[model samples]
Target: MKSLKLISSAIAMLMCFVSMAQERTITGTVTDQSNVPLPGVQINIKGTKNYAQTNYDGNYSIQAKTGDALIFSFIGMDSQTIKVKSSSVINVALKESSNQLQEVVVVGYGESTSDYSTRSYDRAERKKAKTAATASVALQGKVAGVQVQNNAVYNPSQNVVIRGAASVSPKNEPMYIIDGVPAKANQMSKINPNDIKDLKVLKDAAATSIYGNKASNGVVVISTKNELYKNLTEQELDKKLNIMPIPSEPTQEDYDSFVENAFESPRTAPLSTFSIDVDNASYTNIRRFLNNGQQVPKDAVRVEEMVNFFKYTYPQPKNEHPFSINTELNDSPWNSKNQILKIGLQGKNIPTEDLPASNLVFLIDVSGSMSDANKLPLLKQSLKILVNELRQKDKVAIVVYAGAAGMVLPPTNGDEKQTIINALDQLQSGGSTAGGAGIELAYKIASENFIKGGNNRVILATDGDFNVGSSSNSDMEKLIEEKRKTGVFLTCLGYGMGNYKDSKLETLSDKGNGNYAYIDNIQEANRFLGKEFKGSMFAIAKDVKIQIEFNPKQVQAYRLIGYENRKLRPEDFKNDAIDAGELGSGHTVTALYEIIPTGVKSDYLAEQPDDLKYTKTETNSNNYSDELATIKFRYKKPDGDKSIEMVQVIENKAVALEKASDDMKFSSAVAWFGLKLRDSKLVSNKSSEDIKKLAKEGLSNDADGYKAEFIRLVEAVK
Candidate 1:
């Protein structure tokens, strides 16, 4: 019996050793010599079928055992081989190959000969093309480095390698420009190969050079005979696509255009009414543009968002109201002759533990457009971070939309984090974007499992490339408007770059009484979803509106910076039927107004029109000359429809620009940068250097380091 026990112990010990030798998941990032993330870098386990490719953020996870050799390869970069050691994390920075120039042609357009390797498959030649479901499959072996893996009759996947892998993006997928507009490679899955007029694959760098970094992997130009009209203008194309623009890359991304606000005479328009904005999508989107070495779009530069992106040191609300208002008047940094008035609102902060129970629905887009590594993959990672912050009382449901909308995870307690994460992991991207359908299903789930008087919200994550049912901006706006009455708020989190639809997402969030943010990287995910969980998930006030009554005695004319889209009719301020912005717990909102002092001469102020016929202008009888502006605001409780009014008066006082608080200086610098980006005629001759100087002055004890990042962004402008 003793001998038998010893034998059993030996067997158990051997089993443990064998288990330890089995494949384990290893994760790491790949970058270039300059520490820039390299997407599409191919990583493989030597002598094994296990492999993984880096996502848009240069991150990857693979199944490999200890002591196994891993090979990393990308075109134009030196190959690297590393053996797994004790650590599961392996990071590699590849160096450019010395003989890369000989192998790769420089990508440029308008060259003398335009002699770069190019292949064209005209309609006549492709008449007998294989009847494949996807464009990639149809092109099969015709194009070099393009291979189709037929796993099953129903699941045939294609992988296109254009002159090997390029680390320009997170994935090795080439940019697909359909007609004159740029699109994602996976979008071609929806197009019929028979409808293709001319399919040309540009393999040389010179042919793809026009697209800059977006074409690092290569460029595939597709022309559809029946679908697209040749030589359509940008406006016509945008109208035809029915998509909003997300400006960054020179792509089909759309943005709403608006002329700059002209100086308004307090005498003509006494009440300046508008909604308070808390969304910061514009700022981060602009940052992506600057980081990618592209010009920032003028319409994309929303000054209010840029100013509010950084955290401010405003005092917490101490009254019955959910927020506290503070105002400061200082000399305008750009126009020395004019004064800049800063209005700030600080929402009451609530501790995470004391926050109410949350019934959160994650509305994720798993469409073909979201197939980019930065889109679906990054979104999953971001949501996981939020899951970690959930408390036991909090519940989460996941609703995904592709060709249709469906619920993936039921309402599960936040404590069941592993289960939620597992569901997220199983999600794959394909099919058209039925964004409107997705929103309907998400709202249904939220309403069914409604947590009365608790934090009920739907967080929509997508690139906003909606093409299927109810996808247009007007349709989405009307849909969200109806849903906002359900007392369930919405939050739009935008991801990806090329072919991003910022306008649609903006409309959904704006009408749904929610906030919007653009998640550019994992760090931004941490900032928006993790670090700002209390503020992002819990709303202190809803339908918040601001109406400023300028004092004609102390001010001549003033123009509110940004908030152009949020402008409300003078009578809309009191109407409870109209929707406005929301204020979250611990959130801070800042607005700047360029004011021309009563006697100050300014070029921005157009010649005052002659007195209106048969109209008499009446001045305030309250004799409040000591006040520069009377600010009246209204807000409703998160669950209430009625708004409570509050009023504050800005004293007619001016402080030197140097005497302003750090927040004032930093926010001003950001506003200046925004105006500069927009090429506004209001700004005096100011260089980026001047803005950088002002930002550095306000770089006082920035714990989050956001202020420092702002300074760096300004430096990247030129």
Candidate 2:
């Protein structure tokens, strides 16, 4: 009987292992209505991490247990989840997204379409760079272990040093890759301010080793925004809603969206806090409209983004913290009676050579929606520019999605330029868009090839016309939010126009620990991929937040200029779990406030009620000084989960607008432009001529010709 009991126990244990390991291989093909196989589709067991990527032929085999649900998904197609009973075969046929779109056409690689909307093609925000308007300023002083040196406000190049130079090469510069292609340090400086999204800095041996011998220096990665920026309505652009635009038209759903932000009261709500918003898409989109001779929309103009888009030339940071604090109080250009309190944060700059290795996935959308020459073709050329700047050690994988998603290239060394280029050339546009599946597969590829402390990212380039399954902005956003937890970052690049869904793209980029850029042409792409690669590709600091407490004794009412969307609750400033914008190496950020002195009377100020019947009014403490306000912010190292604190105090003394530095005047001019564009009640008396004159006068240190460009854009509006 004892022997029988022992045998029974053994049998029980054996059965347990069998049940625990009840895994079976499920094979299937994902396809569209045309019966064409889909590649790179994502197949996985529901509620499990076990997932598989389809091969080039759209064939997939995934492991799952009996009764477990298997999910199959494509980007623009409906997703299918099947429960495993006994059958191992699970074929899926995905159709186009049923959600309506405004005739977004996709042509083959070789064809040129007769689209009438080509003449008005346009589209796309982020971190404040230093004294300079460029992104490098924002990245400075942010990294804990890295040393950054900022150039003059106008100088775009920054010196970066990583993990104590173990070994050095000729230039001792780390290679940079933006969106999976190699790039030069200076190329990072040229990207459009609004086009940028996130930066990835790779350091240490484990991360650097992947880049081969060259990585002995380090590597920086840049991700651009692929989401929509702005699109004109068909009736508004072509005088006929019946004649749809080339890309897409804003739908009734989009037009029906409502958003509003009210002014704050200094009497009761004296303290103001918000997440820093570097997204400047509003400014550029305004330029496109004006250049096309179209009237600007009030809802589209974000005052904070427009003002923050220009550089303010504040003093660079000198302490252990990432950004330097610079404050200036001056009379407002729009309202001389009001005081303009300017606060500038200059993130320490790090030279490019000192950065780390990288692991990158180039996720390109080849869906029929991206068939325009400005979309797919332009995307290819832009990626080529980035590839040319790569080091032999960097690794890149190409993932494309359309009617279905697929991996056209595995992890190939950067030096294998021919192979990479050939793979790019072979890509063609057709079929429904499987954006969800594409993101899943691309991230899967990135995670699989991820290096423990390296720059791991997926650069997603698309036209923002997701329609198929799980294509809702919320669904795709949740998907990216979940994936970013795995230590992978995203860069979204928006291409083409019309069908562009700016809200969808911006949300995806924001949630994915990445940045967004609208690539209207190769010039913008080169600026992002070639010139500003360092600042564009690598992040030096993350989760940076700011809070300000005004002296109600010295100020009665105040308003922030451009960051309406970045407002945060005071408590959120201390919560490390709340993610904020990132600062790139040498990146700079600037903010402006229009304040009404305590003695001045302004209609915008809140009416003070007689001492409440239930309680006495509170009096100000420590009110005897000339201090204007106290500014405090929190930041964290790139990979850290916690944030560090930083505080700064300002004076109440005001300077004349003319007496202020050129940085102030230029940014102020941009602010007025934004206000005028929005028809803000605050700037009713201001005119475009005033803005143009001030912008021209403030064009000091115009080394990069950007100031000149601004002047031209302003003039075009006339």
Candidates' TM-scores? 0.72, 0.64
Q: RMSD for each model, in Å, please?
A: 11.6, 21.7
What is the per-residue lDDT of model 1 for residues 263-346, given as tens digits with 9 covering 90 to 100?
Answer: 999999998999989999999999888766678878888888888888888999888999999999999899998899999999
Q: What C-alpha lDDT, on a 0 to 100 scale, does residue 307 get in candidate 1?
A: 88
Model 1's lDDT to the true fold?
0.81
For model 2, the stretches where C-alpha displacement exceeds 4 angstroms are 1-261, 615-617
Q: Return the top candidate by lDDT.
A: 1
Prediction 2 global C-alpha lDDT: 0.67
